[model samples]
Target: MTAAQPFVQEGPDWPGLRIFATTRAGGVSAAPYASFNLGAHVGDAPGAVAANRARLRALLPSDPLWLDQVHGTRVADADHEADPAPADAAVTRVPGRVLAIMTADCLPVVIAAPEAGVLAVAHAGWRGLAGGVLENAVAAMGVPPDAGLRAWIGPAIGPLAFEVGDEVRAAFARAAEPPAGAFVPTGGHDAAGAPKWLADLPALAEQRLRAAGVATVVRSNLCTVAGNDRFYSYRKEGVTGRFATLAWLVP
Candidate 1:
């Protein structure tokens, strides 16, 4: 197995805060789900996934509170919820309570309010983004969004690779006015001949976070589909494993 190379947070440093997202490197799963597959529900060997988690745990303060991501808006309270539940995002104020969100092509959004001692992570696909998952997570933190809250948009399918249909665009339009250039017409069509537009996942996420009043927003600018060798991308590989993004207060 290769050594794990996770993307560690570098800026807007807050005291006692730890945040990072894993790459596709390291661990011991075989092809398709090859090395470093942390997801248990993605058809990877159970033993392999367990081993991967164990490896990841060795680097964390405690076993992370993993969520059952449903591409919805539910936010789990990691400090109160002992068992994993069906939710797309999680929030915690207690130090050592590591919160995790698994994703491949979907965006992994990490939010922190150092002053309030709160941190949250969300799994945001187009559906969740348009459905207000970020908004919900920010609200769950109990800290005013405009009050020094910062967010990071982790790797996901970039705009050039994330082609979508009118329905997808309509969803964001129905929810809120998306950023002016969030969706750009590709002047192309899919197998069904439907018009396609490249949707910028990170841009959409940034817009939402800013609209929610987050004081600082940063994007990894890493494209999963484009950088599939280093990051898992379901959009690029149909049968693939997932990587995780985690955050916690340093204890």
Candidate 2:
């Protein structure tokens, strides 16, 4: 598989930070995984995954600090850790150290406090988001809520494509002032008469970031399920590969 240029996600709002989220367009994996599958645990060939990482490393300062995400609120310190940690989020205040979060349908959030030399990447599926992964990640940065911080919400299952039952809706309702329009009724009911919903992962993420004191929040607008050719969507295909979102400071 050939190397596909990463979709770079950087802007003046996040100066001194270099960020990129991979697409499924480039690499060596075949068929279901196609190419550019960065996840090692997703049944893809180890060599293919390694080659893909090597290709990705060409554009980074160092290998990304990966995590074993458990859909929980644990946040790991990328700079101090020796190996992959069991956490949903990874943060680092050192330069040249990449913090990565793997996801297919789950929302990939990268938060940065450039002025403080801090960066964090989170894997936020419904369970993680509802359980306060974002809040824990922000708190781990050691910066005040009002600190000059910026966040970018990467692609995930979009609202129109994400159908959930009452339990999912109730979780967000439990949060403080869950953003309006974040969850829309699907005009359908479950077996228990509970209203079904099409949850907006990005909107929900933005709301969480705002509540955590992030001043500016931007979303990739790329939907994994919608852009099947460009992204790996686990919700769309049960047995599929996982792409990643990586972020680090410029040394």
Report the lDDT of model 2 for residue 208.
90
The residue ranges of model 1 lying beyond 4 angstroms of the native Cα positions read: 1-13, 190-194
Clashing pairs in 1: none
lDDT (10s digit) by residue, model 2, range 112-205: 9988889998999999999999999999999986679899998788878999998998988887656888888989999989999999989999
Report the alpha-carbon TM-score of model 1 versus the true structure.
0.93
Candidate 1, residue 54: Cα displacement in angstroms equals 0.5
Global lDDT scores for all candidate models:
0.86, 0.86
lDDT of 1 at 60: 91
Name the weakest run of 10 consecutive residues (lDDT summed) in model 1. 5-14
Candidate 2 regions off by >4 Å?
Answer: 1-13
Q: Report the number of the highest-TM-score candidate.
A: 2
